[model samples]
Target: MALAGKAAVVIWNDVTPEARSDFLAWHGREHVPERVSIAGFRRGRRGRAVSGGPEFFTLYEVENEAFLGGAYLRRLNDPTPWTRRVMPAFRQASRALCRVEFSLGAGVGGFVATAVLPELADADGAFRSALQRTAEALFAAQSALTGLHLLRCDANASREKTAEHGLRRETPELPAGVLLAEAGDAAPLADVVAGFSEKMASETGRRFEAGRIAIYRLELCLAAGEVLPPWDGSPTFAGEGD
Candidate 1:
């Protein structure tokens, strides 16, 4: 199980309950396609919280950190009318552009348990070393864990340009580090991650605040050449050409 790509861009947000349906429609029909069509994008996956935390999550795998500033930013700057309409409806949006430091897994799964840890004052070398050690320990403990990826936020690559489109909820502060573990079932994986968190804290004397773990069920996943269901009766945007 090698890493999927050099970097991953993650977006987590809560959509107003009233806008949930349309939000999902736009994401599946327009957003995912538009992103994956970009040259460096490998895949795009979206998930919804099955347990606790934000209602929506999206992950985009890109060739490298440079892709964030290249093709990706160009799209972000030019929003479709539908994108313009849907952007403002997102609440508590948090975006992160991350460098994929380590990954261990054979394949993706139906569910993912993610742990977002706050930044520490430690130097980059020490911080990455600690995360690697913890991730290795977790992998050794659970065989069903299909993927364990550690992402370090690349602050310069993160942006909130959507604000210009009137979708201006303050971006949540980026996590210093993110851990994503995939599994067939959410419940058991959640428990495993919890225990792993405890072990990491106890051994290292570092406290990752509780309630930061979220479990999500895969909702939409797309890659190049996949046919997207027609956006029947959905709102249209002028010049929506991908």
Candidate 2:
């Protein structure tokens, strides 16, 4: 792996039960490829919110800042004919992940799902159970999934940042969450997205909550002087700010 600049787009859409399966397949097969082929794109993948919501995530890896700048913007907004054709399947509201460089590392990927704990806050054990069940359904539907870990915030780990884009922070009281999935490149991501829909439907009794599910794409940036760990098949977790 190598340090590369990453950009992720989060889209929330209105999807129908009948079109769910077709939607995922189209993204995994047709849509993702079109985006990955854009100049400056080294890798790409798509993911779905497994909670019956219109939320979805797409990730793109770029060579450098220059590639993500003026020229890249033109190409993205003025997508090729292929993209023009595929864009209709998705209803999207896009959010940009601030530019970050990640170290080539062993972990699958990092994620942050917010606005969910509030919904589950009053429910306690049942909430945790349902949350896990939702995650399981997502993975089961998408067999390519490797691992999912639930992180409970520790009091000392809390911190906050606010900017023009959005408010971002880590707080123990705030209920933070993350998911890790197996991925090599963008090609296989569509399957995961499709599978996610099926699983969410099964787990949630077919009712989707659009406002409660928030999905984020992450590029794991190693702090200054940190080195990628050897891939030894051991479970690992990075402590706060490590």
Candidate 3:
């Protein structure tokens, strides 16, 4: 499927190993479903870093740009009790609401490497065309890369707004754009991505130097209506009076 929507919300962060189980439980069982159930949300996926530290990334596909400032913002503002409990434990979180520029691929893979590129000053057209050409070349190679996608950040939505919720880490200055490449093997894919980045920089006269690029391995994936393992623990809700 050609990228399903016009926008996507990408989040990167890490939590203590001690809190990993509770984190995954909240995300897999509660968080993802709640977000996916919202009006404009399409689907969500999560991955863990294979080599990079602070190991977790989540992607939420949304219908359009408005969804970010509208429904999604409301959801973020009003957290569930479980969300309040688990979210404060997140460390080094970075979030972006991006406009999907290009997507070329067939299926999900075992690993994904992302290149976060800075937005050019006054050359949007040139940058976009160059990226498209590079994507075509990569697509034609039919190499190990299982998928490729490009996303342009929506500045207003990209702000580190989570500070209000009490996760003390400073929000990162959002990247101008993001390039995602996925593969079944992490090692070879990393090499290919490094080469591809060089090619992109050389061809576009641009550098992907501002933000870090890392590879993440698929950990757990959940979708709407998918049954989660039964939780027989005590009930938790955001507004429930303890």
Candidate 4:
């Protein structure tokens, strides 16, 4: 499919384990399919914490900004007790999304997907710091990145199940290379990957593995309430307004 405009990557961090179960069940059961029903939406993918995230990371993509800003907002404000409870309890450390001004090459597609982040000498802090530096560099370089999200997984157990989640099955391998980036075109993206590989090799004194990693894209679907799609690998949307 041609690249859609106005894509977004949302990172949601759970305040507690109790919240994690609710969030995942809700998204899989109610939210995703709802978003898919909306007009103008094309395809959407959901990602779980294969490597790094706040317990979990869900990516949404849509065709228009209004669904995210207006329609989505309204759903969050719905006064129904169920809506009220799920809406307010959620916490966000950071949320970022942007339009696709330019890009080349299609999203990596396969049964297993892995992203290799630099193996920091300081495993705890190095990955996070490198991620931040990369994001800043991309923005400063006038890259086409529209969104940014950084998360620390709540537990290693969660990473194994990332692919079982509906959206994550697209790439089902352990991560090695960068998870996210902005590209102006195919040439720039190629340059970025080459430079990134070189930088990692020099810093860690080892060449980063490629077959273990893959490129993946995201989409958001928003529709009125409905039964969410099954985890058969189909894309969906759930309406959490605004």
Per-candidate total of colliding backbone pairs:
0, 2, 1, 33
Worst 10 residues of 4 by lDDT: 162-171
- In lDDT terms, how accurate is model 4? 0.41
* Reference-based lDDT, each prediction: 0.77, 0.41, 0.74, 0.41
Task: Report the lDDT tens digits of candidate 2 across residue range 1-242.
Answer: 33234433223354445656665555554545555555565666455554334456554555544554454455545554444443444443333322331122333544433232222122246554665676666655644444333223222212222221121111123322222244344334444443433454455554322224444444322222233433333456779557
What is the number of residue pairs that collide in model 4? 33
* Candidates by TM-score, descending order: 3, 1, 4, 2
Off by over 4 Å in 1: 1-3, 120-130, 160-166, 199-211, 234-242
TM-score of model 3 vs. true structure:
0.85
Candidate 3 segments exceeding 4 Å error? 119-123, 160-170, 224-230, 233-242
lDDT by residue for model 3 (11-80), tens: 8888867888898888887888888877778778888887764588988878888777666777777887
Which wins on lDDT, candidate 1 or candidate 4?
1
- Highest-scoring model, TM-score: 3
TM-score of each: 0.85, 0.39, 0.85, 0.44
Q: Which residue pairs collide, candidate 3? A: 81-238
Q: After superposition, how far is residue 176 of candidate 4 from its true place, in Å?
A: 24
